[model samples]
Target: MTNLTIIQQSPDPEQVAERSRTRRSIADKIRGMGQNRIGALLLLLATVVAILWANFATASYEAFWETHLTIGVGDLQLDFTLHAIVNDALMAIFFFTVGLEVRREFAIGELTSWSRALVPVIAAVAGLALPALLFVLVAMGSGYKNAWGIVISTDTAFLVGALALIGPRVPGRLRVFLLALAVVDDIGALSIIAIVYTANFTPLPLAVAAVGLVGVYFTRYLPSGRGPVYATLSIIVWLAFLASGVHPTLAGVAIALLVPVYRPDRRDVEHALELARTFRQSPNSEYARAAANSLRESISINERLQSAYAPYVAYVILPLFALANAGVVLSPEVLQGAVVSSLTWGIVAGLVAGKLIGVFGSAALMKITGMGEFGPGLTLDRIAGGAALCGIGFTISLFIVDLAIDDPLAQNEARVGVLAASVIAFILATIIFRISDAMHTDVDPGQTLLRPVDPKRDHIFGSPDAPFTIVEYGDFQCGFCLKASGSIHEVYEELGDRLRYVWRHAPLTQYHPNALAGAEASEAASLQGRFFEFERGLFTDQEHQRPSDIVRLARDLGLDVDRFERDLTAPEVTGRVQDDMLDAEAMGITSVPTLFVNGRRHTGPYDAQSLIRALSEGPPEATPEPQHPGG
Candidate 1:
């Protein structure tokens, strides 16, 4: 079963219950600890309080986040308000996650292979350019004309969830279409954040941020092969940019480049597996044991070296971020202002109109231009209908609005615009999805969160209740896999119980000469729950196969290499590795480090930073925001 247990240390429940009602009060508040409505409501309350303070309270909103405080860093005096601190400092972590997500998608997920990614890339580029053009056209000479780039974003989580709420009536194409369009929209929004939203740059901070960006250029080739270190460094760079007055979120894009992007070696994999097999199938003699022990040690080392730094950003950070920023206060004034604001109109119009123009126009233009055509069973009406639904830019838009305009009027209007347009687009998309279903006569799937479905039922992977699955496939000799030991530790810290990664053998025959034997060694570790340790050994070493490497790594990680070796080359265990290789080959895998979350393929040469992002995005769209309290 998937690990869905809510944390037992549910917080001081009785205290909150006294402050509110019972069902809606206590349980709600407890639920709020991890981002249910209570948490969002609390955040909303805080934001409202800030607004009240700014507009009416004895203290001002400026006072809440902007209270000037002086601190020392060597001889430099660092002065910033509480607001700037969060926006400039804390927000960098948020951007780091973004960088992780983008990196993974480009390397493996939706964008890695062009055959699968072209549609979205093309759509994203088009979606971005058109919205800016349309916004400029719509506002021509209006008062809030500077916010054109903000109009193109699509909040993936909100839109996709809404799409699921109404179910199959929305066609598969609609969801994929939205994903492509939204991802494209995200790239566009980031560009805008980088170029237009930030403050007048200070040279020192700008230089720092630049230096950080430069680090990313070489991150894919870092010698440490550690994902978390990369993530941490990425954050520092982001802070530098933020301190320099650049919008903090651009840091997410900046950090993504720093992650290592190498695939597993094939020859190393084959060499390791061959020795492992000979040891496993040999008679129960002294020579057999020695052979097994010798081969096992080598395999163990390779696994350990490759596993660190893989999980932190995927669970704790991303989920927490969603909760912190999704809250919005709803009031008559907020509504009235949004109704009158040009920023609101531009976004609403741009998403509603620009999306249609961009998506439909591009699809039609592509078809007519003879560059593209709908896959077998799609129609223009369905395509345009899906296009119209692409106006759901809630999450990314909200993030940008905070960065672009600090004014209360502009912020709320943008929120209202996102909320309104997203709702309308969702409804329109849902209706169109259902219409498409009728035409296709597909089966109807019921909606049930946290409920298990048959694995074959097309519902296992996205369920909140799905088991924490960990997947690993490695070569016995691959060094990068050997280095992943640190990455996995970070993932465990952030996710605790909600994470499950599975291991699969993907010993490539081309390199890592001992790769297959290494796969067998790790499987044997599973017999004693020491697979984690065995994996640690593989990824840490970059050097070629050494007989004592695995044993040494196992000892360091606290495993009995004697028993570990016995199992590592055990006949059935070795057979299991062989079986996995066959299975991976059947699935069209062309590389050594192939990974799958649930069953979907991992697309990139993942470091911890990128893998974590892919895992947390779940079924949520390319972009996600936390659910706020009221609306």
Candidate 2:
């Protein structure tokens, strides 16, 4: 206390500013872990812990996960073992994330069109059918015939984790193919659960679930506080599904599909930003809370909830699930029986050999029939490697074991088979990927332009006098570009007036139909000094970008609607759009979200740290001349 009494703090504002900057830098790094690699590592760790605990402390492992728990009001109490709770309740959240990912892919990702989705859809169907056929053939007269669904579904988490372990040598497009295939596989798994695994169907609870979903649909339009409403409706749907005899987790998917993917109106967005700016300019507790609420209301509920639940589902729910379900007590007798069990052989053959054949064969058939062609970097060997990785179906396989097979012996045998097959798949995929990596030579297409900022023509933000300028050539309809917006905002926040951002259009018109219209809308808004506002609106609502919608957004943003409409159709505005496109073509910038920091092309990920590093290092020694004037 005596020593503390003499303590003093530095009055230098630079030191205080330096400390704040350091804290923000740390925060940026932490927030940049959205790639889910850490989640995969955590899942792997949980699985290892489960196996060690099952063998070393058998009684404790069983007793902990097997403990019964009950919750409800009055006589409406529901009871379940800890294991059941993890599977039936917590896993619903995980499944909800999967459903969101699926919806997002279908909405704006590579699967947005039939041309892109066709091969994956066919492959997934074949992937499911072949495994089931193989399982039935292996277990035909052996009584475990109905457990075919156990091997049909691929475990997204485990497969992704194994791929992540293979490092950056893997092609990006191949990863997209596997992820899309897994999503389609999940759809098939849900169909199987609904049709094949249900013991009985009840009309009352099924109807109640439908009503609960309707409530969720209406809640999307709520002016404020939709979270509690969604949570309540989700619970009702889950309970009804549980009583209806359909697997309860399917409710999560249904609810996720119902979440609104559209952005709020421009009035709401402007008001929300005003509130936020007011709070920042003059801090007060009331203003702070109001700004927070307003900002939350501005974002779509789907995005808000996804960001909120992603970490919890990834780290806590999945790790706990792995710990509870991955344990297989391998006694001498159990091991001997598992080695010879028809169920074990059926699962092993179905997952490993069956997945490889089903995935690769179906893809070949697609190419051979001229129904679909391979994506970029997806050669025969890479596809085969990805197909092998698809066999690592640990999580979902165990889930189906609990559903399709009632016999404990069969369950244990199936678990053992799943564990062994996953290891085999990982090893096989790694070797194949390594070989493919060595066989292929990495080629750089020499894209990404190093161009100076043209303040007069560009849609600009931040101080005009800033030393560093960040240029982003991006499309409104591209999902990755939309994701990059967050990273860009973070960098803007950290650098403040030290940095400026100039946005240029580089829409992939072949992929995004509304991209041209969106770009014109942004240009029109810029004539009224609302370019950033309109651009943000377009990015937030990729699905709702008709001409009428764009005009309505401008009108709501306090612009003169007639003037906006005139500017939207003006030849000069159209010329501006084409000018950016011409620049993109000249620079060989084929992809959206290409960036330049301080006149040097930034090739790294558009995350905060990477951008900051590029900025700190400054531009290259010689500045390349701008390809086009006023660009």
Candidate 3:
């Protein structure tokens, strides 16, 4: 082929895509994108209303927002005030979009290719980790202990909206690059909300969420269904999420992952449009008859369905989120709080500092060391500005702050920081880009965001040197014993130095053929000062953790094999195992996994909080409330 015939690139590859943007006139395209800004405007209006209501408006907006509204029967009633309803319920849809965006970016967007993706993905890691560290450093042990999570999340909507105003200065590539970066940032927010912070579980709401999940799978993923009735099922899922003690906004992300995003086939749409016009013609005429014949032959259900579904996703879902959550009351107190608060400092520093140190720093270092490179049209200055813009931490920030700090001052400070950083990042990025007379940067991202290596699931107990006993009874083949890993982990997270878990074999002879040998292996591990490591594997390995696997695990944990072997077959080992089981039996601990919280009994289904409460409350302790199963 002639060099002249070569086509280096086309933004939209003429292939059918979901809500596909046109590459017609760049200026016109930007303008069209602006129309999409209705979502931003709606968000802004909501923020304004919320702020005015919170600070100055006559009625207590704060009280109205925070007040619980109950639904259903006594004790069965779902209690959530206005803020919770909006934050958890309506926000689920927002999370669904987040899920969709994350999915799509990985599927085809800038995140689809790794070489191009290295910079942003690595940068996102830096962006997420550093800000989180900064917040933790400042908030921990303070009233904001619950709020360490507040600083880590980056709000993409607010970030992008800021970018929009910086028009002509930011290039298309920068926009795509910043978008990919921020989307990953959103995922980080999700991780923090799910893992680092959560309250004790309550059953009803979680049960609702589970049922809603069932409904979603039946209609959306199951083959035996009609098209997803996203409305009713969506509401059900939202309700469940609200009740589950989980921030409900995540429900949106869950739905987005499960919801289908494909546009109806264009060819099918064309054929159906023709059939609709013909259907308008009279029924009697021969031409009408022919039209009817053609129409019957031409139309497809999927095509007609697509036509109906297009408008809802394009207009409704997103705009609603913006309207509900985007209200930022601009007043002197809010502004002053931003200046005086550590949340404000942490946020501004984390973003301004983190993006610079994390994204740009890593990118530059990687490039210099021959490890990574930059997206097209991006200059160092632009990158710096882009980093600043990423400081936009609204939606996720609000969600985290809700969980992180229960105190009013800290929460308010966090809110102020989120608003101010978003605004400042937007303004700074706009100014820098305008100075260079550039608009948007372009990038061909090539990889996906990297999820962290899952930590050792086995419970890590008392440090390498400590003296406390935790007797864990087990049958090698028992399912509960197999499931003990997570249970042990919760305890460890709650009580680190005060205890260590010791394995004992109560192996119901009917269930475990080698239970005796398993206990011996654990005893052997103790001989080599690596019993804890061996116990962790003994519990966590999903498959057969045979006596031999215990040896292998010990070796991996740096045990002295010679001593380990000698201890495994020690004469008194089997009896030691039996004695612990006898103690458990006498205590009426019918369960495979149970804990003695400083000589107090805690049986199966006991989490950290329960165990802690059980320990403290035992021996003339206060009456304990009923335990929530998962909580």
Q: What CA RMSD would you report for each candidate?
A: 19.3, 13.8, 27.1
Looking at model 3, which ten-residue stretch has the lowest summed lDDT? Answer: 444-453
Best by TM-score: 2
TM-scores, one per candidate? 0.52, 0.68, 0.55
Q: Which stretches in model 1 have alpha-carbon errors above 4 Å?
A: 1-86, 89-91, 104-118, 140-142, 167-181, 212-232, 268-329, 368-370, 376-386, 442-631
How would you encode candidate 2's per-residue C-alpha lDDT over 117-214 as one tens digit per residue? 78888888888999889999997866989889888988887776667667235344466678879989988888888888887888899899999999
Residue-level lDDT for 314 in candidate 2: 78
lDDT of candidate 1 over 1-631, digit per residue (tens):
3323222232233322221111111010011123222333343344345444444543433344446889778887778775555555555554554455565456434454454455656766777778777777766545667777667776554454454455343234445555555665666677777778766878788787787777766654544454565566666776686577777667766665455443233334446566667667775576565555444444322132222212232233333333334344457787787777667778888888787777777777776765642442235556666676678775566666776666766676777776677667767766766676677554222211111223331111122343454354445554334433344445555566565555556565444445655566567666766665566566555453444565566667777768876655444564455444444433444343444644455543244554565565542232212222210
State which candidate, 2 or 3, has the greater lDDT.
2
Judged by whole-model lDDT over C-alpha atoms, candidate 3 comes out at: 0.56
Candidate 2 at 2: error in angstroms? Answer: 86
Per-residue lDDT of 345 in model 2: 88
Residues 1-631, candidate 3: write the lDDT tens digits: 1011112222222111211111121211133345435555656666666666655753565555667788887677777777666666656655666677776566435565676677788888888888777766654544454465666666666566666766444245456567778778888878778666756657788777777777765674443234446667777777676666666677777766654443223244346556657657644476565555444434333233334543343355444443344444546776776676666677666655665567777666776777654533455667766777777676677666667766666666777777766677677777776765543224211111111111232223556332333445455555555544445555555556554554445554434544555666777676655656666666666355544566577778888877776655443454345334443333334345444444344432343444444444532333332322110
Cα error, candidate 3, residue 326 (Å): 7.7
lDDT rank, highest first?
2, 3, 1
Query: In model 3, how large is the Cα lDDT of residue 123?
Result: 80
lDDT of each: 0.54, 0.75, 0.56
